[model samples]
Target: MPRETDDHDDPTRRTYLRYGAALAGAGLFAGCAGEADPVPEQTETPRTDEPGTTTETTSSGQAREACLFPVGCREFTDPPDSVTTYNMGWADMVVALGHADRLRTNRLTAPTLFYDRFDIDYEAGYPALWQDGGFSKEVFYELDSDLFLLDPNLLEAWDDNWDESDTAEIESTVAPFFGCYNRRIRGEWQLDLGYPEQAPTMLESFDAVGTVFDERARTDAWLELHADLQARIDDRLPADPDPPSIALINGGSAPGDGEFYVLSLADDGYEMKPYRDLGLVDADGFAGIETGQYGLTDYETMLEVDPDLILVHWGITTGSVTFGGDGAFDATQFREQFVDPMASHDVGSQLTAVAEDRVLPGPTAEQGPLVNAFQTELTARLFYPDEFGVLDLDAPLDVPESEQLFDRERVRDILAGDL
Candidate 1:
């Protein structure tokens, strides 16, 4: 069952706060260029220990602490007035919590098309934390968010200039970091930087966010909805499932160049949750292809493997949003760029997946509860058109109300706090 609430007595929040306060009292706020402010002293109250009940303190006092990977234990004095995120998944969670207005900054271009369906203009005048191909320390000070929904490990891994000291400085002076880079274990850098062996599921991560933001009700509703959808799909699935073998590749990959970056269908992360839930087989494993070096493959290797289906990762995002200066994904344009080249190539057209036109757009990895719901349905239709219906590539979410896996109005109500 989904975790509806956290009832355990978490003393870590008070302990961590006291530690920071002691450091602040010592005037050791490093890297703020002598303008660093000390961590504020938090007033706490006794918390109730009851099942299905949260341990949060009064609104005027320190909040109950929540724990997750990378950033272990953290507590907020109140629901964050403003937050900063480096990924769409975290941003979407804030939006789903009806705190879209609290988003102060984002790292990537927002997936506005998906947000538009929920009547959210996520990117309107939103500041980008990344500038000129890298992150600037000054930006963190400038944003001065109440909380940072970012993984500290990622900052250290992505840029050599950022390290534990930098993260500590910001935590002491600006805000606490409360995010995990559990999308997919990119490389050894993450492990070297103390990434845990196991991480929470997408829904679990969402629940933690809810706890921090004091939005447990919204998160609970989402979990219940997700559980219902899971049950529905489970009941409908074949008892003796012979799921299709698929080759998952990045959307930016150019097949004409004979180079493709194959992603794992069996990886342990929220990014691959939908695919794993569907029981889809990984073609890369069968082909003895190594995804270690970023899963680089060529047409000759692909022809040798001949997967049953070819799935373009982040295809849905490209189709819906104009990302990274690339125009929105158009079927004709995609064909011209990917499909047509494969059909014309001497080595590409012979593949079973290409011959059968099984090349389809896959969902994005940066998904929260809201995007995950729709993506799961979209993937189901794409995988089993006979059972679910033929998905229109141009407009993926155009499924009839009766045919949709979940009710749009119900989701809208949840987001609108009408639950």
Candidate 2:
């Protein structure tokens, strides 16, 4: 299902109290210096689809069947020389296609970030060193990444704060990072202004990054996972399953809990096509409000419609729903002060979905390979349950043991932090 627009700018909102620390508690990151280059001339190339036999040797001399980002000493002959990734989505996607040797390092549990672009809760099953506390440190320090594929929002924030020293440190130590599109850019100029029926959906995102990383086939396979999952989901759902007449709360609670931004399949947000694909029908009188990041909705109007499902987009950093706190971002403050208020409405709780509690929350941004697939799978399963066989309704679906970032909680804790 597609996610509703923000009630207000929550991602940029301040959540937890910013306790002044001396780098000891959160383990402040210190830059890593450059090492011997792995691959020579770095260039974007398509992944090899026609399977061929080849062996990749790690720096440690031990080379097992490399799939995704393998932990321990490793090296790559790619553009950035040697690199590890923090985003579990990236790790999961990479390893799923048997290219583990291409990268190294994984999530080192710490704390959650302000907003989760990719689902982190599902990666805690395995052990990773880094987690929350810092934004992208574990990924930066752990791996020898030459190119960092990140959401555009994150990239903009980093670009604003990054200095020559930081760049030099990363380049000398690891490699240059690449900015990945997140479908959430400024309204003045950008595609997919957080719309359920606009450009840059997960499918488009996979195609975009997959092109840059030369992992198109891997990406296609990942995308194919969604198709398979969705088909199964469709087959399982009631042939005449009622369309979830949904109205989503922007960043806070539904006015009458009668809003559904859109139908959600993969926790990313809601996409209309998926619903139509599943043969779900909706009322034509439903109104959709577009307000940039904040999906300023007509709450009263929603109550009149009495949608069947209510999708509340909650996390941290929605300015409109701010909690007077001292931290960078505190979801509890927002939840209690703002989000909780909306929860009290009789109709809000009495709506069809409210009675059934069909509330699904998702992260705002981030489109890591595996993360995208997980979202797609989760959403597909939710929208088409019978065919999909009751998938684990969670964010960042688990990658197999052999795949990297299998540890679910580690990723979740890391996600608890702010952007």
Candidate 3:
């Protein structure tokens, strides 16, 4: 749980009030049952640095503001003492900025698998925001975080009870929401749900978070390290390299089940950053699968395309975690569960990747600067073992120090505020 704030000034009251008023005027909130509820008193007098200034100060204290799509401008007094996030990418960003201790709670549980490799003992003690297969607004109120690194549109899309008013009410009474939903492209049916059509890249998003938390120094350090690793990989690849065609799928996919959710390897979201950076070809394109469809295919379909490689997404994190509902990623277990089944099946056994043992574990979609750095290197090794060195999927962190693409000790130092 997050540490409770002593100050009840509610600095964001003015902003949310304006937002709510606009929505009410547009009839967006008309006939709402909670419309009669009185707005909280404005204890903090607002201060503008300049006319039409986005930055301002509340009577309670100095406040900083930053704008990210989906959730427009957000104002907060000082860096958040405690924050809540449903997405692991945002949570990892907070951790990279040396604020893991401030994380109140999050929905994902496998971050520790990556963090622990860098000696980051990140453990969230509170219950997940998601409960009984849906998000719990009561948990949000109970946590009482200073900020929510969550996209409001995601709530509207995932929770039947959540709406624009619910978000506005929380911002007015509690803390403002600041997040962008760029994990993956939502279905076309969900387009009108307020999802941002365009969003910053993963590193760009990290920079915005740095601004919000006043941690530019740490963010800059991580960015520099990221650039160094990317350059290393770029320098090694051939100018006209023929990248392998690959099929990316959920880590939990079982070939024996004959159903698999195929992900886009060339999507614009941060989840595909590593694959894009490596210039891996999307096998879906060859298979006549449309991007963003998130379509499921069977073993026979996989045989038709015959991707050069089959990468299990979230394989590293899901497999590394010692304790989780989805058991860890052990090589023997993975082979038994996924590989052997494919080798035995008539259609699966015929696939080139299956016969050649080109199937391998891949990275998680929810990655920040820290996780991205490691995953990029891991993927590089997985894809081109002859050049970058082999990666033991079961023991991903055990890469020989000489084979490492980035400095592990340096990253640990950066996370420790030694940068």
Candidate 4:
């Protein structure tokens, strides 16, 4: 649970050595829907930097630059006026920085759900870009954007997969690319596509984006708030509580469908933060299950491990459907389909989690800073109700001002440029 935001809950690349050869054969490719959504467009480029060094401010002192995995060092001449997001995570990051107005396009097919939850609306007169399907190079060129906040590897998942060449063209001709979609180690497809083995932490990615947008001061402020949250969470870790072994899975909307998409909790990524920070044991990883990059398993195999709890991850991608239409978060539907079906199944009923109704719905896998904070808080309340107060899933949190995990006022002020 989280406070009703005046705004919202809210809230990459390397190997640059062969830069020239990559650009030579760059050509148009059919777009694909590899991310949670698609972004608009922008124009700008960057200069290389030696690894390890972080920030690189321009000589004019107007711009700031930073680096993360995969994308080496990229400089921002000034804050980007327009940006496109390949997924909701990046969109949330931009919104967290008070630049939702800068978004050229995005992948949010259901903007009403998000905008209502976060209490943010794009500035009046700014049109929205919804990538219900995949996006193309032609659209990028037409948009003439100032920045592309997307993960390059996701382009490989597209119908006309973008290679290193296409990426180079976009950087040289359009705006520089940032962000990583493979942070969550879902299955083996990412391995074939050469997704980064190690993804940056949520905070690390935020810091890098903040630098590129010349929003470090605001980023720092948010970081401080997150730090306070971590402190509060630490204080609430129940003494000697049985840390439940949980299986993290992604399922479809169908009940009888045998789809069980389990993510590797062992791998380091932002998606695993809630599990890790709250001290949940990884049932699949611990059972030595050979989980592929994005492989699937039948219900029979899943019952072998018999985890103490089942955490269903939902609302992660644009392909994901919110049952019952706009502004709908159907817990009843979730229980009837995802939780109950598995629990009632002969194979699944034997599991400890199922017997106790311990299966729980998790936050959207495409979480950013604000969402992460809320998810973490929810997890804490769920797992340690005695240590942390009980949370009403359907209602906003009632944390007092003194006990607030984050400074909402600070975030609003920062977004409004009042700080």
Candidate 5:
């Protein structure tokens, strides 16, 4: 459960208002400091399983001037040396871009575990500012990072107490917030919550981050690797094959007992991008849960659709096995505490996925380009074991030479600037 905190603070309000007034009068910028055009609503369906196809790249140029969004734009003259990152997605982007050394603050409570999962080495005692502390404006001031690789919309989503004014204060006093909230599939609730601006796709957000860091060449290299991986996957896809119907679930974050937050694939959020890109049909989208994002569904709601497969998404929260639940991320704990319990539950046992043992853990929620590549491979194995090889859960995630989707050594070299 989240810590209960008062939404209103009279003294903080007074202080913020006074400081904001001064900054505005002095003509401080409130938006990003890089140039970007308005992100158009992605109405076109994702590319089919056709070889030699590429998605267009909208970001270019090396000199960071301004990043445009629906709200406005912010200009940047100097690259940031230190950055503050929120959650696994932002942290992963920094690591992927060879800027992990610049991460001043990180969200993963177990930094070593994250490093091990990604197979990256860092200082033995690398310090972290905080983890899952629920975004403090005071901490932002104290850390005083050169840039914040987070979306203002996300800050608001996490703590509705924050608004545009709060975001402005961070940009004016400390540094600009540069990324988009690329997680959720847009829903009606998002508009009601005051986040009407559509977030960028994972690739788009990464490109923006590359622009901010003046690493367009590295970004291009990564995109090339991604294209190659996609081409491989496409070559293996059977022509006009009917993919299985899937219901994505983050069982860890049940708002209450016996309920789960069901993810909709309709809007193509970052977490579902790989699955959506592969043309897997979302069972929930077919069921028509359109008005809600991260909607809480009970056993009855789940049983109604009875998807062919159930994908359990990971990293919903740090340390805890279940969001707002007391547990950890160990294999024994996962099965004993989560999998076994759910498998035996009256409602859970009745589901088609459980009966066929089709309930499998999905990819990490905090995804980057490389992570997405891994996820795409994982999904292919899960859905089409006859076509792609079965995934070895106990073994290291290293793919065999013939089975490798992308060159790991080459990616490492690019990130290490040895390219």
Candidate 6:
């Protein structure tokens, strides 16, 4: 049945895009309860129930169930027949748990990422594969998967009324869907949510995947590693007086303007719940943008802010190439040609983020796990190196002169800027 437009899930884009002024929390838009949840799309054929195995805990008080996934840890007594996995998030989580080979079929990102990851780029590989811009249904169905861990919002690609609709009546065999709380609302993914960076989120996802995989030990280990990283970041925060205020800028092709589309911390400060997971985005400190979508601006507005540091995280989904069209960090021609000139504009130039060279894009081709962890740390390190440690992002992108950016003391010195 088609969904009613007025349903809670189908909030109008015009109104929804306004974002209702988020309050502080773990994530920006409540990531729809659990990440494993999927909006019922087409389901797979059902199989007879089979005997399920139980997980055994390790000697260190960690169970096979919790070891793999650390956040939403649960003992999935009965593994679903032919997982009809839905989103890219879990695909990545599963791989990290050392069980990706068992995946039935995934609906979120594509397989090209799988090949790329197993072969070349590990950073951008996972996210690129799942949310990878180039997903082909022919290839998707060809995998013949069973359980579906999906993001309900992706239904917009098939049915317009999807947010309010239900596909359960169709007799398709599928598992319950998981989703990031905020992802339930359409277009919410575009906002930064200043939610904890990707690392902890992945850990949380690991917890969720652990419940299904029953790898408590692995999940616990991952959690320990996650905590260690957080501690490392926390202990390292710059002690110098006058902590710098940071801003994130995105490169865009729209309006041919020089400024990047900006993203703001949720509820103003950085210390939100999700920030706790990633140790960034304190809501009490700074205010975020309200409009949420890409907008053109001149150099003057940037100077007005007098940003202590400026960081670049560019992506133009608003272009003609999005929405079933081919578009992603790789497909865009901006990196080689427009990257420098775009940053060198009025606002791009005056800021210390630009002059001292503190910009970093948010993609790593092969390190799927690291890509998930990039956001909070990438930006945090740029503004407070003494605290966050020196960050090296260029090498992963294989940018020419990438080594220049890798320098411990002065990264921007050797990097190229062509604008």
lDDT of each: 0.66, 0.37, 0.66, 0.57, 0.57, 0.36
TM-score: model 5 vs. ground truth: 0.75
Worst 10 residues of 3 by lDDT: 2-11
The predicted structure with the larger lDDT, 1 or 5, is 1
Pitting candidate 2 against candidate 6, the one with the higher TM-score is 6
lDDT string, candidate 6, 1-419, tens digits: 11112113222352221111132233332232223322221111111110011123434333334211111222345544344444444555555555555566422233232223233222221212133332333333444444445433344333334332242311133234433332222233323332222212334444555556555555555544445545555555545434446554433322135434554433211112223333334222224433233433445655566565553333322111322433233433434433465355655566555575544443221122323434344445544555455554422322233322222112111111111
lDDT of 5 at 81: 87
Please give each candidate's TM-score.
0.82, 0.45, 0.81, 0.75, 0.75, 0.54
Q: Is candidate 3 or candidate 6 better by lDDT?
A: 3
Across 1-419, the per-residue lDDT of candidate 5 in tens digits comes to 23212111111222223222233333342332222232332212223111111122224433344342322234555568888876556666777788777777635433343345446754323244333545577778877889877756555555546666888888899988766555553533333322333345566566666666777678778777777777777888888867667877664544225666666555445766667666676785534743233455677677778887777766322234223333233444445544565577788778888788676666666677666766777777767666777765433244576776677678778777775
- Residue 217 C-alpha lDDT in model 4: 71
Regions more than 4 Å wrong, model 6: 1-87, 103-143, 153-159, 163-165, 181-202, 239-243, 251-255, 267-298, 314-339, 343-352, 362-370, 373-381, 387-389, 396-419
Q: How does model 2 score by TM-score?
A: 0.45
| Superposition TM-score, candidate 3 onto the true structure | 0.81
Expressed as tens digits, the lDDT of each residue in 1-419 for candidate 4 is: 11111101011232323321132123111111122111110001111221111454444347566664445457677788988876666677787788887887644433433455456776322233323333467777766779887766556444234466777788899888877663353333344333333344566567678888887677777667677777778776866768678777754433356656665455545666776676676775533565543445667767788787777765322223334444445556657777677676777777788888887776565556666666677677766777776655444244556545566677677677676
Off by over 4 Å in 5: 1-63, 66-71, 109-119, 122-134, 156-160, 185-198, 253-257, 284-294, 315-330
Of 2 and 5, the candidate ranking higher by TM-score:
5
Model 4, global lDDT: 0.57
lDDT of 2 by residue, 116-144 (tens): 33432323333232334224443466554
Residue-level lDDT of model 1, residues 270-332, one tens digit each, is: 777778666676875544585334466788888877888888887776544345433244676
TM for candidate 1 is 0.82
